[model samples]
Target: MKQVVAVTSKAQLEAFIDFPHDLYENDPCYVPELFIAQRDLLTPGKHPFHDHSPVQLFLAYDNGKVAGRIAAIFNKNHNAFNNTTDGFFGFFDCVNDKEISSMLFSKAEQWLKEQGATSIVGPANFSTNETCGLLVKGFDTPPFAMMPYNKAYYESLIGNVGLHKKVDLIAYRFGEDGYDDKSVRLKEAIVNRLKTKGIVIRPVVKKNFQAEVDKIREVYNSAWDRNLGFVPMTHKEFDYLAKDLKMILDTDFCLVAEKDGKLVGFALAIPDINQILINIRRGRLLPFGLFKLLFGMKKINGIRVIALGVVEGYRKLGIEACLYASIIEAYRKKKYKHCEASWILEHNELMNKALEHVKGVPHKRYRIFEKAI
Candidate 1:
């Protein structure tokens, strides 16, 4: 018989985290997440996300064999910031059976209803601040570091369940001969003009990394405030994120714009460690897996332009273009083959145009879906 159960015990939670590895075992494109990192992110007391939000994990089984898993989320911060009673479903992976799919959604919907949620939305692991979204297109390649990827049938499964698209997210690729260096040629002029206004762009200083993180957190929260599904991250949450990103961050690609010593904007890109991660079996780092991770950095050929934002007053002054140019200059100098600038909202005209100006093309699409509870 088919069955679905709450992941309540240590063993069950392990099952929840490992199911995808087995599910995608034969798929060449599947990239296993680090088992330990996922464990902490899902465990309540271990991550700062748990300090304010509640999440539950569920697993579906067929004759005791794990068939699928999902996380139900009720983000108090998201609701408070957006002023709505919204619930979310995330970490979703399932087999192709309609009955099993319906069973999983029913269980999640039942739990969300009890929490007073008026709508259920996502594929968000916890929130958009994390890896969220259902891959509706672009399954030909492995995901960039920190981006979501899933079976193509996922879209059908979700649509069959009455969920409708909430929004689409775009990922752009700058391939060989694809980068337009017009901005780089014009960067000096832009910087000179901005300097006349007391603004300058520079790389982040490693000595004051903590202080820099604090400043960037302010810019991050303010710059993306008007974005859909946005909520201001708490100090603890921002710190947690900064520490995690620091591991793969290249200081040169992390640029900041300042006006008289205060940050007004920033851009962050990291080496696509997925190049190495994809080779590490089952996302483990022990018993020779550690060697691969330690020796793999030199082989990575791409970078992910994960974030680029400017505070309100800093926009439209060519800061965004200059940030793109700075990163492109570094990318070329490092001899990286390509870069992926991702998760831009489909309607975000300013960002879309800025990226396109440098010959970036949308190479993938991810979607968030919602259903009334």
Candidate 2:
């Protein structure tokens, strides 16, 4: 018989974190997340999200062996900001059995309902601010950095459990001979024109990193306020994330636009470190894993533009295209093999059009599912 149990012990939590490694042992496209990072994110004291919200982890067992795992999350800030009583389930992984999957979902839903949540929505690890969504398409290629990947049967498994599609997040790919370069070709002219208007485009200054991060945080919060499910990240939360991103950040792909010394927009792309993590043997960083990360960085040839936005008042000034053009131009000089700009909302026509204008092909589609509690 299959049974669902709330994760309470440290041993059970480790089992929960390691379950996917065992399940996808032979799957080439499955990249094991770094053990320490996942542990830190889920632990209350280690992550800032837990400061304002609560999350419970659950694991399903079949005859003493792990069958599935999920997290039932209550984001106090998300609910308060959006004025809705919605709970979330994230960090979901499971076997192919429908019964186990259903049991897990039932447990999550029961907890959410008891928490007074009227609806449950996710696959979101915590919130839309973090890694979320189930891979409904583009399973052929491994995920880029910070993107989610799952079994092809997940769509049916989730649907069978009563969760229906809420929104589709698109991932676009720009690779060798694939990117639209009209923007890049006109980059010089674009910058020159904007310069005449007192807007200067430049690379982020690593020397003043903290100050720059603070400014970018402002732009980030303001730029994305109107986006679907977007709740402004708390100060501690943004700082925590910025600290992590600083490790792999490249100045060439991190650009900013300033007019009269006010930060108006920014774009950030990081080298696709998944290439190294995929070889890290269960996401360990000791006993030669660190060496692989250090040595492997030099050989990585792909980048993921994870964040790019301009403040509302600055939107139509061609800053968006210039940012995309600048990143593409940097990619060309670096001779990178691939680039991905991801998790774009399907209904975001303006941003979607900007990407399509640059020959970015929408290659992957991920879905966020919701069910009434």
Per-residue alpha-carbon lDDT of model 1 for 1-373, expressed as tens digits?
9998998999998898889998898898899998889999999888999999888889999988999888889999999999999999999999998788888998998888888899999989888889988988889999998998899998999998899999999999988568899989999999999999999999998889899999999999999998999889999999999998887778989999999888999999999999998888888889878899878988899999998999997788999889988998998888999789998999999778877887888989999999898
After superposing candidate 2, which stretches have Cα over 4 Å from the reference? none
lDDT, candidate 2, 1-373, per-residue tens: 7899999988998999999999898998998899999999999999999999989999999998998999999899999999999999999999999999999999999999888899999989899999999999999999999999999997898999888999999999988779888888888888899999899999989899999989899999998987888889998999999899999999999999999999899999999999999999988899989999999999999999999989978887889889988998889899999989997999999879878887889999999999898
Q: Candidate 2 local accuracy as lDDT?
A: 0.92
Model 1 CA deviation exceeding 4 Å by range: none
Instruction: Indicate which candidate wins on lDDT.
Output: 2
Worst 10 residues of 1 by lDDT: 350-359
Clash-forming residue pairs, model 2? 180-358
**Candidate 1 — which pairs collide?**
none
State the number of backbone clashes in model 2: 1
Work out the TM-score per prediction: 0.98, 0.98
Q: What lDDT score goes with residue 305 in model 2?
A: 95
